[model samples]
Target: MTFPTIPPMHRDLDFNGPLSDERAARLIHSLGPLKGHHVVDLGCGWAELLLRTLATEPEATGFGIDLGEENIRHGRAGAEARGLADQVELEVGDAGAWKGEASDVVFNVGATHVWGGDPVVHTENALTALADLTRPGGRVLFGECFWKRPPTAEEITAMAVIPRDQYRPMPDLVDFALSHGFRLYSLSEATVDEWDTFENGNAWGLEDWIRDNPDSPDFDEVVRLTDAHRRLRLYGRDVLGFAYLTLLRV
Candidate 1:
């Protein structure tokens, strides 16, 4: 017997991070006008923000690359539905290996792992990559996770595979961006409300799926996965923080 596999939890979210429509709008607004400019989104899951930017500036062209083919497919459909098919390109590729021309605006939200290896090391490497990827005085909207406060050992255990020292504090993160030759234009952290919404959305989506496919063979595994993720989020919701940095390559 053949049973369909369960989809990833992120499939339910509009953006793959703790971002709301208002926050996204603010981030886009900070990029200023984008008419006739080139924008690139690395590790952009479905490129929701990228598509919205192009819709606002119809003359701008954009490209998004992600490792997930399903995400790329969704992005392509979104672009078509939004009447941006002619101005946007979505591809399933390695973000770290991208060698395209420097972009006028760059987005690297919650995807710094594209650089690979140690989380701390890769963070700096990702910043360096974005520096080279963006033209001088160009904007790079970088979103990353940071430690709100030191987590207890139990809290770290609840996080499963994530390392205790995987992320730096918010101030250190800003310092890293500054050290990378990026002038910070705006800095904001995801609010508790946004975090709750993001965490609940993922669990709700999985629960909905379970209800829709009660008899599926993968049900048990999906339930376990959902529980684990929910537990982890609940434990680390306060200790972990996500920062959105609007930076300009200097």
Candidate 2:
């Protein structure tokens, strides 16, 4: 199903994830000293994390790669506005194929599709790629969804858009990280409020877009997406959870 184009205002927002700016800042702070280091962000939507890292670590430089043209454009503008144009580079490209410069930190948030469409393959491949790009003792922060509770078969069927095997329990994810030769430094899970904010924000944006473009040909698509977002929020809120895991390369 075709999704509605995100509103321009939404594109200007610094973040497009479940975590709020405060939570994102906390995660950045947890990365230890970034000063004088080089960082890479794969699938860096709008480069929120990259920009934040640059702002926090004035001596650090960063590269952000994303497939979305608008995200790249907005991220570049944001870097310039923050006087970080010299310190950061934003490129429009596939994160999977972009073997980033060997850097101190590598971040991939909510874009596991780089590895492949299959969720299990995507997670494993992404972890491997992140580890390869990070220098020894460097850090990789990966964000993904997991099962919050034991989902019933009916619930799993309802969320069939995502492969059932892809959503592992939290312990299994930790084990997967350990098996990949990385130490789990820390992890931050999104709160229910954060999830609600993300979902409602998307629905609100679509509602505004639909209202403003009532005669547009994409009206039906927008409506469909708006409905789907609401349903997912209502039904999956209890079963689905998101987390940002900080893995230290061994």
TM-scores of the models, in the order given? 0.92, 0.92
Tell me the lDDT of model 2 at 32: 88
Spell out the clash pairs found in candidate 2: none
Candidate 2, lDDT over the whole model = 0.82
Residues 1-250, candidate 2, lDDT per residue (tens digit)? Answer: 5565657535434477788888898889878898799989999988978898899878999999888898899889988899999999999998899965667998988888876656668888888888788898999888988888877787766665666777678888778876886899989899998887777665666788888989988888778766766766676889888988998889
lDDT by residue (1-250, candidate 1, tens digit) is 3334446545667877899989999999999889999999999988999998888998999999999887888889988998999999899999999999898999999999998988657788899999999999999999999999988899999988678767889999899888998999998889998888777766776788888998887888877877888878988887999999999899
User: For each candidate, what is the lDDT?
Assistant: 0.88, 0.82
Reference-based TM-score, model 2: 0.92
Off by over 4 Å in 2: 1-6, 9-13
